[model samples]
Target: MPSLGADMEDGTLTDWMVAVGDSVSRGDIVAVVETQKGAIEIECFEAGPVTDLIAREGDVVPVGAPLAVIGEADASDPNRTEIQAPPADPTPEPVTSRPQDPPVPSVPEAHEPTPIGTADASMSDAAPQQIRQSAEEPKASPAARMRARDLGIDLTGISGTGPGGVIVIADVEHALEDVTPARPLRHQKDAMRQAIAAAMVRSKQTIPHFYLSHTMDAQPAIDHVTRLNADRPPSERILPGAVFLRATALAARDCPDLNGHDNGEGFVRADAVNVGLAIALRGGGLVAPAVMEAAELSLAETMAAMRDLVARARTSRLRSREMTAGTITLSSLGENGADAMAGVIFAPQVAMVGLGAPHKRPWVVDGTVQPRTVVTMTLSVDHRANDGRKASQFIAAFETHLNRPDAL
Candidate 1:
């Protein structure tokens, strides 16, 4: 139960990707926890052999609870305790005919306990036999499960190609090719909406928010994208949204006040501008996963990252870090969105930049009126962390970057 977001206090351990004795490296997906948002792949932060599984599937654990224990490679210690095997059943029957104590399973020397999720260590473990017996609900990646559900395909029939016989998204797609498409299943959008509502309510109640809106001339960015896309293929062409994102990232970099998290005690500025892109899910929910280190990425790179993030978010393939690493957020309405819109400040983040649909408008230019593309940019800021002056400066810097799209 990693803290996927501020609103997440606990999560249900939906699946396990690794078992005891399995070697895991940093960044490996060890388990999947279902938060209110959705199923999130929990990555391993330590490297070594897994010595214990503390949280079993279907166990609801809170954030920072120890979900497993990892051990060092060396196992020469004489006093080392043997690894405790997962329980065969949640409640085992009492045995009256036992003659002696059962032998404990030997394992490598254990290191510090690694906190993965919140659960009582005494809780019943998911035994290996139990894991195998539950073949009707086969092991699959979060993306695979979502895809299978959407396609109305049973995971029990498909063979897994992923490590430890875990079904992946590719396998689901391959299965789909052999059969007709079924009606897509409805997602748990109600739960997601409730989560969003709770977070927004908390944000409003805790943070003093002030909003500022600026309408900028978008003709330069629009023209620049057009010229750049003319020679490129459709797949490689950049959209105006990318330009806006890049501009926001750069502006955030220059204006420190607008680009960091708000700790309860004080403000902590972030070194890298990780811009969280607010993407609406297909069924009717939203997720904002960051394009990590966006300030350092090129315009094309930013566009690619945004596309990838959106695609992964829709399929419930987002990692734990992506869900929690946003320092500043950007919400865009794209070309078909409303002319102007304001967004709520995502808790802990100091600022949120909103981009409205770009459209043609009459503007005075050099003593004469001219029809030009214009976009309304709104900034919602935490007043405790920044005032109106700082917000205006950030907006001004953003406009400067947006106007000079060639430099992005």
Candidate 2:
């Protein structure tokens, strides 16, 4: 299983998108793993034909465990050894099997696709039966299965719209709309809360956190946005949050100290600034899915990314990379939120930038007091990876970017 997050030790393999002999390329969504967070679409990082399906559906494999073997076609060996030994039982038994293919070259560890995690004994006991039922049941995506299960909908009667008659989440949703009223999602909020709490606790225990706050003049940014959106439709107008994210991304790019994970060994700066946006789910828990290469995206692109990220996050449709690729994080309380609030640092990530609600405040501009739109920004840094001086410089760069919205 790919380490979806620090708290995710294992996940249940809910569905496999590719079977034996299917060709897959880098970035293809090959599988789906159900975790405390939700069903995350697992992406393939290697390109080739899949040689074997090692971990079957319903198997709760640990992180770094091989799910399948993708190998070069020109390999001479036809009976390649299994990539790794299957999990010891009480691990769920396979419900079905595929014809074995010729032995293929082993995928390098660095290129191996991360799969799902191990579940508890209770889940293991239930897995075989569930897998057996699913094997004979209607074809459906993992998200669709979870949705149908939660809503008590029968899958056999519903027609799938996905590729090759595979049911998707939308199909499940459509079934609900056609029959019963929509119900609240049966998300594991308590479990999610526990996971979040554990990660935070680990961060607090191991990471030495230092904090800094700065109030920025937001009138320039507000004016710039107003002018840009003046002729556009309401749907096309930009939110101030995007501007803040852009500034934060640029500042992170400029200040390397604040832009990467501290891998226990030392501070490793990221090649690109992937800014993780702290989005609160409608149910209860929170997720910070990154807008990959934020520094390279234009203002409009950043806004679009934020909107898409939030929508997918709430629906539990996020990809595995989005869960794990964040180098730094940003938490923002919009226009109606508090004037200022300090945020906890998401560990491994050396810093987090918090943006409070922008409001009018008395300020001295050229020694004259005036009401200016202002925002309180807070920086939480890991003392081990970054000191007070470097943190201060990051905050200063952030302020400078916000002031010059045109350059953001």
Candidate 3:
């Protein structure tokens, strides 16, 4: 099973997409595994015909365990040789232990396609194991297998859309959408809660955390977005969250300390700004998927990616790249959430920025009372990587971005 997250250990192999004799290529979605984070599509790194399927469906295996063996394709074929073999070995003398003038590469053995678990047919117990293995191997990825299990859909009958006929999570989901035993929301939520607990425990136990809070006026940002959207279609309208994400990313330029991971040895700064957006899932869980290179994207591009990320995250459609792409995190509570939020730092990441719901409040501007849209922004920093002074400056830069929303 592949490690879906830093916290993942053992994952249950839910299905196999390729059968024993099927040919597979590198980058194929091979199997589906169920991790605590969610069902993830496991891609194959080796390309060849499958000789053995070692991992059984619904079996929980540790990370790095072999799921299947990819056999060499016609190893004995002359066309497979890269360098030409010299002619005239016909006059060769008797074999001796002494080394030759120039060493020759050894010829590899030829292999015919074998059934699942029958690659080594000489083993005494091969027949019984082979029968069981052949009955269970269907060539699906771990995530696809888990989804099949959850939805009570049989993998043996479904066709895979992934490379090399490997069934992926999407294929299983489409099957489930048409027919299923029951929705497994409660069970999934419980599993997600456990995963969150383990991660938070690890985060607080090791990382030295400190807090910073600041309140800023939100009128400029709100007005800027409203004016920009006035002439555009409803689909192109920008949300307030996009402004917050872009501003936080821009602040990283001046405060580089807030934008990387601390992997025990030392801090390794990231060259790009992939800001993870903390989204609350509808099934009573949360996931933070990154918006790749947030600082470099225009306001419209950021909003478009944010919309796509949130939609995929909630529906369990996130890819491996998005899940592991975070350099730093940004979280917010929209209109109904708390006035201010104090967030815990995700481990390895040096900082997290949280935004509270923006509300209208009375403010004294030039000796006159005026209603202004204001929001409370909180910055959670890792004390080992940065101090309160730098944290203050980072927040100040963030506020500055919010004040000039046109530049964002």
- For every model shown, the clashing-pair count is 3, 7, 17
Clashing pairs in 2: 1-115, 10-117, 11-117, 78-102, 78-103, 79-103, 80-103
Which candidate comes out best when scored by lDDT?
A: 2
Highest TM-score: give the candidate number.
Answer: 2
Alpha-carbon RMSD of each model = 13.8, 12.1, 16.0
Residue 210 lDDT (model 3): 89
TM-score of each: 0.71, 0.73, 0.67
lDDT tens digits by residue: candidate 1, 30-114: 8888876888888777777887788899987645556777774345644333222111111111111011221111111011122
What C-alpha lDDT does candidate 1 achieve relative to the native structure?
0.71
Alpha carbon deviation, residue 111, candidate 3 (Å): 44
lDDT string, candidate 3, 1-408, tens digits: 444554443567887878887887755777777776776666665566776787899986644456676774455644321111112111111011002211111111001122443212111111232212233566654444544554567888888765466665557756765674555775577568856764565467556788999988899999999899999998999999999999999998668888877654446677888898999987588888789889999999999999998877766666555566577899999977888997877766789998999989897667998899899999999888889999999999999999999999
Candidate number with the higher lDDT (2 or 3)? 2
Model 3, runs deviating above 4 Å: 15-32, 42-59, 66-184
* TM-score of candidate 1 relative to the true fold: 0.71
| Pairs with backbone N, CA or C atoms under 3 Å apart (clashes), candidate 1 | 1-117, 65-117, 67-116
